[model samples]
Each structure stands twice: as structure tokens, then as C-alpha cells.
Target: MKIDIQKDWGKIKSHFRTCNRRNMHVVISSVDSDQMPTVTPIGSLFLNDDQTGFYFEKFATKLRKSSEQNKNICVLAVNSRKWFWLKALFKGKFSDYPGVKLYGELGEKRDATPREYRAFQRRVQSTKRLKGYHYLWKDMAQIREIKFTKAEKINLGKMTKEL
Candidate 1:
């Protein structure tokens, strides 16, 4: 069902946070020059209060290439935690949305501001002690902005009928 992206911004933000934690990343889909489609898994997406967000562009080579040609993109965030599913299964209904799809267009690709960089650091601070953290996020200096236009709550039979 259609969601009022502005009105439900708080819920959207919470859902995305849970999605990143449970699923590790959100899937971003874009089209190439020939209308060919591609999907990129991005873990650094952060939503602002104004229905806009950005993602670190360090390793998304294909997404960068495709975004240059086609700026339109779709982001899918799913809450796939085993306990969430198990609870819904037992109750025969979901208390909250299980997923959401965001429709947006790519904006400027620019260097992240100091504040943005700090936010990114905070997001990944839990993994700072890991060996791969430095290898993966040490050089995430650039970000591509996204202005979201619409949101759709995922529908799943009677499980999500109330939502």
C-alpha cells in the first residue's frame, strides 16, 4: 500500500535501521544504458529527516556507472529477522510492516561533509574492532544523494492486512 513518506518518516527510519541490523544491507536497483537492470547491496545508506538520504559510494562501481546514465533508483529494505517472522507466523498477523520500498532519483555525487562523515563513523563504530572494518569503510569519503519521492509498504496476505 502507498505510504505517506513524510507523515511516516519516523516509522520509515526505524524500519530501515532494523533492516540494516537484521539484513546487513538494503538492495538498490537501477537501470543501465540499455534499460538493463542491476542491483547493489549497500550498507551505508542513511536517511535524513527531510525524505532524503545518501550512501557511501566507495565500492559501488556498477551502481555509479548506471546512475550516470539513469538517475532513477529503487531501494528495498526488508526486515528479515528470524524472530520477527516466527512471531508473525504464530500470531497469523504482523504488528508492523515487514518491508518497504522507496522510490527516488539520484542527485549530486559529492564529498561527504564533516558532519556526514561523523554520522557514518557512528554507524559503523560497533565493527571498528573487527579486522575487515578498516578494509571496507576506511575510505568512504564520497556519497551520492537520494531524494525519495514515494514509499510502498510490503503486503503479505492477511499477515499484513491491518497495516
Candidate 2:
């Protein structure tokens, strides 16, 4: 279904939050120079208020390369919460969408602002005690912005009829 990014921004952010809470990675799809499709899982995507978002660029070499060849990218964020799915299954309808597809064009790689950095840190603060947190995320200093063109609800036949 068509989604007004401005009007449904809150719902979009909520969906991302739900998925992020469960540590579900957002899948970014892009096509390479040779027209081969590539999908990359990213854990650091953050949505902003004005139809713009960014994701930390650490360890996303493939994504970066693909974006360079083709700026157009599609990001899929699914709420993988078991309870949410179970409730939907039981009720035969979803109160909200299970996932959304964001169509956008990748922007230039830039140094993340301190505010952005802090926000990322805050998102992962609960995992501070974990060793891998420091190794994997502490050094995330670069980011690539994305300006979304459209947002669409992922519709599954029969199952998502009421969404």
C-alpha cells in the first residue's frame, strides 16, 4: 500500500524501533555495475524526521560498493517480534504493518555528527557490557545518508489482507 512518508513517519520509526529492539537487521538491496543484485544486512540504520536517514558505514564494504555503482537502494525493515506475529496470527489481522520497504537514493559518505554518534551509542547502550559491542560499534564514525522517495507496506496475500 502507498505510504505518505511525512504522515506515516512516526509509524515508520516505530516499526524500525520494534525491529531494532529485537536486534533484527535491516536488509538493504542494491544492484551492481554488472546488474547483479546484492543484499546487505545493516544494524545501524537510524531514521530522521524529514524523510532522511543514515546508517553507520563500518564493515559495509559491499553495500558501499553497490551504492557507488547504483545510488538507488531499497531498505526492508521487518518487525521480527514473535509476540507481534503471534498476536496477528491469532487475530487474523495486524494492528500495524509487519514491515515496510523504503525506496531511496544513497547520499555521500560523511563523518557522522557528534549528535548522531551519541544517538547510535544510546541505541546500543544496553549492550555496553558486552565485549563485542565495543569491538563492533564503538568505532563507527562514518555514515551514509539516504533520502527516501517512497515508503510501501509489504503485503502478503491472505495473511496481510487487513493491513
Candidate 3:
């Protein structure tokens, strides 16, 4: 069933938070000019209250090229914590939706504003002490906006029926 993106924005945000915590990244797929699909794992996607979000545009060459050709994209976030899945499997049902897909179009790429940069820092604060953190995220300067038009809950037979 289709999820009402406007009405379920909060739930969607929560699911993404869980996904980031459990999986550390979300998968984004876009089609190139030749209709070849490209997928990228983005660790910096952040959702806003208004059914929109942005991701830092760095280190994703294929995604950048594909977005240039076709703005349309799909983002998938799955709560893949081992415990969550084991519990669901034992109970024969999921307490909540295990995953969600958002459909949207990419907007203009621009420099990250102060507010956005700060938010990104906060999100990665726990990894700040690590050397790779500085190497990977210290210079996240560009971002691409996404205006989500639709959301769908991933269905897994009877395991997701309650959700």
C-alpha cells in the first residue's frame, strides 16, 4: 500500500533514523541517459519536516552523473539491525515497517549553508574522534536537495501485515 508522505513524514523520519543507526547508509538509485540504473550508498541523507531532504554530494561519481541525466530517484532505507529482524522472525510479524522507499527528484546542487553544515556535524559527532571521519566528512561542502513526492512501505508477506 502507498504511504501518504505528507501525513507520515514523522514516521518516515524515524524509520530513516533507525536505518542510519543500524545500517549506516541508505541506498539511492537513479537511471542514466541510456536507462541504466545506478545505485549509491549515501551516509549523509537528512530529512526535513516538509517532505524534503538533502544529501551531501561527495564521493558519488555515478550518482552525480546519473542525476544529471535523470533527476528522478528512489531512496531506500531499511532497519536491518540483527535484533530487530530476529525478533520479528520469532514473532512471525514485524512491530513496525522494516523498510521504506521514497520517490523524488533531485534539485540543484549548492554549497551547504551554515545550518546544514552544523546539522551534518552533529549527526556524525560520534565518529569525530576517528581519523577516517576527518578524512571522509571534514570537507562535505556541496549538497543536493530532494523533494519527495511519494513513499511506500516495503511489504514482507505476513511479517509486515500489521504495519
lDDT of 3: 0.93
Better of 2 and 3 by lDDT: 3
| Steric clashes per prediction | 0, 0, 0
Every candidate's lDDT: 0.94, 0.89, 0.93
lDDT of 1 by residue, 80-115 (tens): 998899999999999888999999999999999999
lDDT of model 3, residue 94: 92
- Per-residue CA lDDT of model 3 for 94-132, tens digit only, reads 998899999999998999999999999998999999999
* TM-scores for the candidates: 0.96, 0.94, 0.97
Tens-place lDDT digits, model 2, residues 30-136: 99878999999998999999999999999988889888778999999888888988998898888888989999999999999999999999988888899999899
* Rank list by lDDT: 1, 3, 2
